[model samples]
Target: PGKDKGKDMILLTKMDKRPPNWTFVFAVDVARSGSVSADYSVAIGIAYNSISQEKQICYFWRSKGLKISEQAEEIAEISKNFNHPYLLVEQNNMGQDMIDELTDKYNVNVEAITTGAHTTGKNIKKEELIRFLISAFEHEKITIPRGDEYSREQMSILEDELTKFCAIPTPAGNELFQGVGAHDDCVIALALANRATQTVGIPFAVTLGPGRTQAGGVYSALLQATRGESDIEKMIKLGIIK
Candidate 1:
């Protein structure tokens, strides 16, 4: 009787398991025309961490300011390794046709965010855009992840170049670059991606209507989960969150 009771008392149990969340990835490229070369050829990879709002990663790569096709191929290889959804590219001297070819051959989505818009004087308005980017970095709203030594060096060089260049307004009421032959296109492209992601925030599931209908909201729950109480309150007061 005792043995029968012990056997009857045995029980089976199951543990709750949830799948891990995957991060969204975005890649960006910037190019510039070379004086020596007939065509434009330069590239940079800017990556973003969709899971975290604060950390944005950038990778810099450079090639002869010639051979747009070759440069595009390199980007394809990089994209494959990174596995990003879309590549935000600058459409300047290379032309849209080249971009189209690259996208078709590489099976990549390429979005053209800007043409060749360099920093110029009479462009006081342009400074505001630059300031917004700086603010995002200063406020910890955007981040640039550390890269290898070469990448770090390239970033430093670009930062220095950006500082030397200033936007000034001219009599024409248009902005022009104070520093001639200095381009901030690459830096601006990277900044654009970072700004876009942060400004858009992340999407989340919501409930609407009488039934349990799922809806989408701008703010990502992951953002709240990552923030401290003070930060959360600040975001709420700033109307960045609900």
Candidate 2:
């Protein structure tokens, strides 16, 4: 969306239709600063047909100032509208309040994550979360709305954050992914949605081409995707899956 942005595929492929076998899931990233102060973002990802579980549907909700109950109302509607999506809310800071609002008040069976490591039960770092999404992109296994307004609004935020997203090797040899002066609420939500997709596997398997292993290749694949195409159609043309 900016100068020379498509040169390296800095964005992901965008699509419209969800495959017939896809199932939806919801994820939320609650702000820690204040219930209504910091950014609150949620995204829905659809796990399309295959064992690899490519995410082909992405819808986003984001706002700066909103009470937990207000957010819960919107989430409830989103869940109901999306076939009762499994909700995963980040359980840090005011997030517990959000869960209480959704579960106790809204009657949503929402799941909670203490941190990025909470999902897989193995101390999975936030770095792994960021890298997981990136790896999905590198393997050409993720999709987003092509030009839909609400979806684009969320993808725009996600892309802006991704630009500042980076990793550095620490003295302890652990890699950390962080955005400078930016937040990854949407990105983490998207990642969580995709992880949920992995668990609800479909019957078929998607055969991916050799992944873009090099950084440059990965960037090219991430940013250079087939536009105005459906997921299976796009992958077929890109030679990623057949």
Candidate 3:
């Protein structure tokens, strides 16, 4: 089912124009019952690409579990068409199983980026990521692929969820959707992936032996601080401090 070369070519062209070094993280969900008529056996797919100057361009897609095979094929096709080097995936709940199935069956190369020991908590990290995503969306930095009605609807739902996902008075009042089971894991995963991509920088270079490495700018410095990779002393040493 991969005959749509025209559209794929357009996307691939755009991908090529992006930074040569970039990370594409995709988070996908599949239904447990494998039911077709259910509320989408497959939930959503978040594609995040790291760009230069510590920016990440994100794309969100939604589909049914029954169509995951085709959707994954398209995603893989896009990755291969554009020559993306990495695919960072979030391994939580059924995420790992679905990704594993893709790897084993479709031969898609994906890696799991572990969430380090959280000093604050996973929830806090999730919230921070959400905030960043919201800002990115507001600034029109994130793009949703066209012609996908499901993804369009999910984006609307996400907008509503964000509106209600602010600090409140009661302990449970602050929860999105009154603490219902509508977990924002997909959104949170996307945000974390974007953050990770930004920390490493697009076109990330691995210095075998450090001589004269061109460090990223302020945004990278801030992201490094958030990831606990830099301190005041290091910033000063890097010539970022006065």
Leading candidate by TM-score:
2
lDDT against the true structure, per candidate, is: 0.44, 0.58, 0.42
Which lDDT tens digits does candidate 3 get at residues 1-242? Answer: 12221122111222434444544444443433345554332223333444423333344444554554565565566456535434555455445665676687767766654333232433223334444454344333444332345434555554443333432234654322121225444445455544455444543333222121233456445535643222322332443321
**Residue-wise C-alpha lDDT for candidate 2, range 148-222, written one tens digit per residue:** 455456566665665555555578766565656457676677766665655566412232322212342634454
TM-score of each: 0.56, 0.69, 0.48
Q: Tens-digit lDDT track for model 1 on 153-204? A: 5656545444454545569764443323345555555444543453334632
Arrange candidates, best lDDT first: 2, 1, 3
> What's the lDDT for candidate 1?
0.44
Which is the winner by lDDT between candidate 2 and candidate 3? 2
lDDT for position 28 in model 1: 41
What is the Å distance of residue 184 in model 1 from its true position? 2.5
Model 3 / residue 121 / CA error / Å? 13
> What TM-score quantifies how close candidate 2 is to the native fold?
0.69
Better of 1 and 3 by lDDT: 1
Ten residues in a row with the worst lDDT in model 3?
Answer: 5-14
